[model samples]
Target chain A: MFKTTIFTLAIMAPLVSACGASYAPPTQRLADAQSAERSAAELGANSVPNAQLSMKLAQEQIAQAQKAMKDGDNLRADSLLIRAKADAELAIAQAREKGAKIEGEKAVDDSAAQKATNVGQGATK
Target chain B: MNTLRNLGLLCAFTTAAGLVGCAANIPPQDLVTARSNYERASKGPAQELDPADVHAAREQLDVAEAAFAKDGDTQATRDQAYVAARKAEFAEVRARTLQANQTKDRVVAGMHADERKAVALTSAELAQTKGQLATQGVVLQAQAATLATEKQRREEAEKRAAQAAADLAKFATVKQETRGMVITLSGSVLFASAKWDLLPAAQMKLNEVAAALTKEDPTSKMVVEGHTDSQGAASYNQDLSQHRAQVVRDYLVTRGIASDRITAQGFGPTRSIADNASPEGRANNRRVEIVVTPAATP
Candidate 1:
C-alpha cells in the first residue's frame, strides 16, 4: 500500500512542476514592457507642441504600420514603419534645438514641459 | 495460545458485525437529516460557512456506515447491543452539533436585528445629510453658474490678448526675449509621398513664415512639425517624419531662418485631420504642421 501511494505521488509531482513553470516569461515581459512604455509615453506627451506633434505623428505611423502587418501587408508595413522612424528622429532633433530635452526624467522640450507642469497645476486649454 | 488467538478473532468479528448492524439502522436516516440540515444551513445566514465541512462529514460517515452494513448482524443479539452503543455515540454527536448550531443561529439572529436597526438609523441620518447637501448644492450651483459666466468673460479677454499678440507676430521683423516659437504646422503643406522633401509651393509658404519669424528682433525662434498618415511601422514613420521635418528645417535655413532658433520635427501620422481610409483623408493626413506659441523669456 505504501509503495503504491509513493508511486502515485511521484507521478503527480512532475505534472505539478510542469504546470507551475508555464507562467514565468509572459508575466516578466508584461511588467517590463508596461514600465518602459509608460515613461516613454509621458516624455513624448508633454514635449513642445511641435516636437509633441512630431512624436505623435511618428507614433501614428508606427500604429499604421502595425495595422498593415496585421492586415497581411508586410512590405508596405515595413516601409511605413521605416518612414515613421525617420520622422521621429528628425522630430527629436528639432525639438532638442528648440530647447526640448530628449532623454532624462520627464525629458521633453521646454514648451511641452511647461504645458505638462501647467496641466498638473490644473491649467487646461 | 489458540484460545487466545480465537478470542481476539471473535472480538474482531463481533465488533465488525456490530458495526454492520448499526449502519444498517442509522445511516440512511442520518443522511437525510444531515443533508436537510446542510441544505437549510446553506439557505440560512450561515451560508458563508465552508461547504467542505459538511461535504467531508457526510462523505466519511456515509462510506463508513456503508462499509459496516456490508459486514452484517442480527437485531436481537449481544452484537446488536454493541451496535446500539456505536449508533448512540454518533447520534449524540449529531445532537450536540445541532444544539451548537441552534445557539449560533440565535446569536446571529440577534446581531442581525440590531444591525438592521442600526442601518435604518444610519440611513435616516444619511437622508437628512443628503437633504442638507442638496440645498447646499443648489446654492453652490448658482454660484458656479455665475463663476462660469465670469470665467467666460476672462477667457474672452485672454483671447483678445492672444490675438493681439498674434497680430503683432505678423508685423514683427524681429522679436527678442523669446526663446523660440513652438509652431505646429499643418500636414497639408509639406509632403507628396513617403518622402519628406518640400514641394515648391510649400517652400514658398515656408519662406513666408520664416520671413515673418526673421523679425527685426533678430532673436526669434522657429520650430516646424512634420506629420504623416498612419500607414507604416512606428520606427519607420518616426524616422521618415523626422527626415521630412528636417527637410523643411533645411529649407527654412536656406531661406535665412536662423539656424540656432529654427528646429524641425517629424510626427508620423500621429495627428490626423481626416481618417486614413479615403484619398482625400490620406492627403489631409499627410503634411507638415506648425504650432506657434510664445517662447520662454530666455
Candidate 2:
C-alpha cells in the first residue's frame, strides 16, 4: 500500500507544478490602475467630456478588477487592470491636450490685449 | 528511489517559479518617458510658475518610483509613469500660462509708471513757464514806472526855461555873450546928467531888472559896471561911477538877491562904447552893463 501511495504522488507532482506555475496575483496591476485613475483626475480629466468619460470607464474597470481578485481569479483581475490603466492614460492625454488648447487661446488673447494697449499709448502721445 | 527522485524534481521546479515571480521587472518605456517629461518640466517654469501642479506631478512620479523598486510590479510602474507624464505635461502648460500673465502684467505696470512720470514732468514745466511769465510782468511794470518818472522830469525842465526867457525880455536888452547873458542899461536913463543919484523912474526900471535877475538861475554870478562921459574930471567921474554901481548892487541885495553874487565896478571914462566927441555918442558911452556868469556844475 505504501508503494502504491508513492506511485500516485509522483504522478500528481507535475500537475501541481503546472497549476502553481500559472498562479500570478494581480496586486501590482490593480495598484497601477488605481494610481493611473487618481493621476488622471488630478490632471483635470473631469473638466473635459471625453476625458471624464474615459476616466469613468477606467474607474469601472478598476472596480471589476477588484471583484475578480476577491473571487480568486488573478488572470482576469490582471487583464481588467490593464484595460483600466489604458483608459486612464487616454483620459490623461485628452485632458492635457484640452488644457494645452485653452492655454494657447489665453496666450493669444493676452497678446492682443497688449497690442491694443500699445496702440492706445501711441495715440495718447 | 523513484519517489525520492520525483520529489527532488518537484522542489527544483517550485524554486524556479518562485524566483521568476519574485524577480524585479525592468523599467518600461512608458516609465522612461514619464521620467523624461518630469525632468523637463522641473527644469522649465513648472517649479516656480505653478508649484501646485509641479507638486502633483512629483507625487505621481514618487509612486511610480516606489512601485518600480518593489519587485514583481512592472505594470504598476508603467501605469504610474504614464500618469506622471500627463501630470508633468499639465504642469508645464499651467506654468506657461501663469508666466505669460505675469509678464503681461509687468509690462502694463511699467507703461503706467512711464505715463505718470511724463505727467509729472509736464506739470513741472508748466509751473516753471508760469514763473517766468510772472517775472517778465514784474520787469515790464518797473520799466513803465521809470519811463513815467523821466517824462515828468523833462516837462518840468522845459517849463522853467520858458519862464526864465520871458522874464529876461521884460526889462533888459538881453544877449547871449561868452560870459553868459549881458543886460545893458543907459546911464542917461538911469541917473541925471553930472549927478550920481538914480532918477525916480530909473529906480523903478532897476527894480524890474532886479526881479528879472532873481528869476534867472540861482547859481549865477553878476558884475555891475558904471561908466561916465569923457567931459567929467577923471577922479570925480571915477568916484561918481563907483557910487552909482554901489547903489545898484545895494538895490539888488534888498530885492532878495544874495550880496555875494554881485560885484560892483566903476570904469570911469576909460572904456567908452562909442566916440565920446558927439553928444549922442557920449550919451551911449555913459551906461551901466551887468554881466552874468553861470556857476560851474559839479
Candidate 3:
C-alpha cells in the first residue's frame, strides 16, 4: 500500500505542475482593464449617475482581479479583468451618452433663446 | 496496483459523463444571458448607427458561444460569455451615444438655419425702414427750405420799408395828427406869386413826395390842401389856391401816386397859421398840406 501510494503521488505531481503551468499570469489583461478603468475615470464617469454605478462595479472587479492574481488564480483573475473592462467600457459609454444629451439640450435651448430675441426685436419695431 | 488503476479509470469515466451531460443540458447562465443580450442589441439602434460596433459584439459573442460549445460549463466559458454580454451592451450604449450626437448635430444645424433666416429677414426689414426714413427726411428738408426762403423774403421787405421811410424824411416836414400823418410844403417853394403851376424845383421835390406817399399803406386816403395868405382877395385867392392844389394833385398822380386815393382842396385865407399880419406868418400860412389817413381811421 505504501509503494502504491508513493506511485500515485508521483503520477499526480506532474499533472498538478502541468495544470499550474498551463495558465499564464494575466498581466496584459490586467493592464488592459486598468487602462480602461483609467479612461473611464478620465471621462468623469464617476460624476454621472448611470456611469458611476458601472465605474464602481469596474473598480471592485479590478480589485478582485488583483487579489485573484496574487492568489495565483490566473484564470479567475483573467475572468475578473474581462468583467472589469466591460464595466469600464460601459461607464465610458454612459458618460459619452450623457455628454451628447447635454449638448443636444443646450443647442435646443440656445436656439429657442435666439428665436425669442428675434421675435422681441420685431415686436418693438 | 489494481485499486489505483480502478480509481483512474473511474475518474476518466466520470469526466466523460460530465462532458456528455453538459452538452445535453441547458447552457450556463452567463452564456444564456449573453445570447439574450446580443439578440436585444442586434434589434436596437446599434444595428444601424454603430454597425461596426455591433459586428464586433457579434464576433465576441461567437467566440463565447464557441467556448461554451467546446468547454461545456468551464470558468472560461462563463468569463467569455460575460465579456460578450458586456460587449453587446457596449455596442448598444455606443449606438445610443451616436444617436445622441446625431440629435445634437441636427439641433445645431436647425439653430443655425433659423439664425440665418432671421438675419436675412432683419436685413430686409432694416432696408425697408431705411428707405422710409430717407423719404421722410427728404420731405422735412424741403419744408425747411421753403420756410427759410419765406423768412428771408419777409426780412428783405421790412428792410425796404425802413429805407423808404428814411428817404422821405430828407426833404419833407412830416408830423402826426389825429386824422393822419401831415406833410407840409411852402407855397412859394411850390408856386410863383399868383401862378397855379409848380416850379421846376417844386416838381423835383414833389417827385420825392409822391414816391414816399406811394410807399404808404395802399389802403390809406390822401388829401392835398392849398392855403393862401390873407393879403389877397378871398375869391381870387380861393380860385388860385384851387388851381394850384389841382396842379399838385395832377403832378403827384403822374408821378405814380394813385389818383383814386388822392384829392385836392383849396382853403384860401379862410384858415391861417400865424397872425397873418407879419410876413413870416403870411409865408407860413401860404402852404400846401398833404394829409394821409390810415386805413383804420374812418
Candidate 4:
C-alpha cells in the first residue's frame, strides 16, 4: 500500500504543478472579489445598461468561484475570483462612465438655461 | 515488482504532460482578445488621460501573453487573458469618464464667465441711464425755475398797471378809448386864451397826472394833443395849439415821464369835439388830451 501511495504521488505531482493548482484555500481572493462586487453595486452598476452585462458576468464568476471552493478546488477558485474581480472592476468603470456622461450633458443644459435666464432678465430690465 | 510499476506510471504521466503541451500549440481566443484590447487601449485617450491605468493594463496583457506562450489553450492562460482584457476595457472606460468630467468642467467655467460679463454690461447700462436721468433732472429744474420767474414778473406788471389806472381816475377825467386810455384836461384850465404856458393851478393838476403816468408800465407809450375853438385865425390857432401841446409834453417829461415815450401833437378848430355856437360846447372843444397806450398783455 505504501508503494501504491508513492506511485500515485509521483504521477500526480507534475500534473498538479503544471496546472499551477494549490491545496491552500482562496479565502483572501474570495474576499477581494466580493469587495469589488459590493463596490460595483454601490455605484449602481446594475442600473446602467452598459454596465449590467459586466455586473452579471461578475456575479456569475463569483458564484462559480464559490462552487470551486466548495468542491475543494482552491486553485481553480482563486483563478475564478481573479476573473470575477476583473468583471466587477469593469462594471465599476462602465457605471462611472455613464454617470460622468450624464453629468456632462446636464452641465451643458444648465449652462444654456443660465444664459437664457440672464438674457431674459436683461431684456425685461 | 513495485519499482517496475512506479516506473511505468511515471512514464505514462510524462506522456500525458507531453500531450497537453502538444494541444497548446495555438493561442486561445481569450489571449487574442486580450492582445487586441491592449493594443486598442494604448492607441486611445486612455494612454494620455490615465497613463497609470494604461500601464497596468499593458502589464496585465504581458502576463497573459506570457501564460499563452507557456501553455496555449490552458485554463490558466485563458483566465489571465480574460482578466487582461477586462483591465484594458477598464482603462478605456476610465479615460472616457475623465473626458466627460473635463467637458463638464470646461462648460461650467465658460458659463460662469459669460454670466459675469452679462452682469458687468448690465451694471454699466444702469449707471449710464442713471447719469442721463440726473442730467435731465437738472435741466427740468432749471426750466421750472425760469417759468416761475416769468409768471411772477407778469403778475407784478399787471398789479402795477391796475394801480396806475386807479390813480389817474382819481383826479382826471379818465376814459377808455379804442386807441387807449385818454385823460382830458380843459384848455381853459391848462392855458390862458391863446396862451401856450400852463397856469399855476393847471401845473398842480398836471403834477398829479404825471405821477400816475410814471407809475404805469415802463413800456407804455404816451401822446399829448392840444385843441382850440374857432374864434382865432386858422393859422394862428394852429400855431398856438402846437406851442401848447409842446409845453404840456415838456412839463410831463420834467415830472419824470420818459421823454422818448411821449410825443406832442396839435389840432386847431378843425378837430374840435363840440359846436362853436355854444360857449360851453366851445369850452369843451378847447382841451388838452393825454393818450396812453398800455403795454401788450402777456
Estimated TM-score for each candidate: 0.26, 0.45, 0.70, 0.68
Chain B TM-score of predicted candidate 4 relative to the true chain B: 0.69
Window of ten residues with lowest summed lDDT in model 3 chain A = A116-125
What pairs collide in candidate 2? none
Best by lDDT: 4
Model 1 residue B106 lDDT?
A: 56
- For DockQ, candidate 2 versus 4, the one ahead is 4
Root-mean-square deviation of Cα positions for candidate 2 versus the true structure, in angstroms: 14.3
lDDT of 2 by residue, B1-298 (tens): 9999999999999999887765555577767887888898899978888788778888988988888887435766776776787678667766765665565566656666656765676677789999999999999999999999989887877675666556546645678888888888888777888777878988778877886787677889999988888886998888888888888878878878899999899989998879999999988888888888898776
Fill in the DockQ of model 1: 0.00
Model 1, span A32-108: residue lDDT tens: 33343344445453355754654665677667766766776555555455445434543443444333222222222
Candidate 3 chain B: 10-residue stretch with minimal lDDT: B163-172
Pairs clashing in candidate 4?
none
Which candidate number would show the highest TM-score if scored against the true structure? 3
The residue-level lDDT of candidate 1 at A64 comes to 73
| Model 3 Cα lDDT, one tens digit per residue, B1-298 | 9999999999999999998896646688988988998999999999998888789889988998898777677778888888888888889989888888888898889878877887888889889999999999999999999999999997877777667666667766788999799998899888899998789999888988887887788899999998999886899999988888899999999999889999999989888977798999998998998999988655
Q: In candidate 1, which residue ranges exceed 4 Å CA deviation?
A: A1-125, B1-189, B216-218
* Per-residue lDDT value at A55 in model 1: 61
> A1-125 in candidate 4: lDDT tens per residue?
99999999999899989567556888898899899999999999989987899989989988998998899888898899999999999999999999999999999999989888987887323
What's the C-alpha lDDT at position A109 in model 3?
89
All candidates' lDDT scores?
A: 0.56, 0.79, 0.87, 0.89
Worst 10 residues of 2 chain A by lDDT: A116-125
The residue-by-residue lDDT of candidate 1 on B1-298, one tens digit each, is: 9999999999999999998667566644434444455445445433333344334434544544454466422222222232222233233333333445555555555555545655676677789999999999999999999999999997977776565446544522223323444444445555566666677767666666665555524554456776777788867888888998788888878888668877877777777878899888877666665444455567
Question: How good is model 4 by TM-score?
Answer: 0.68
Quote the lDDT for B151 in model 1.
100
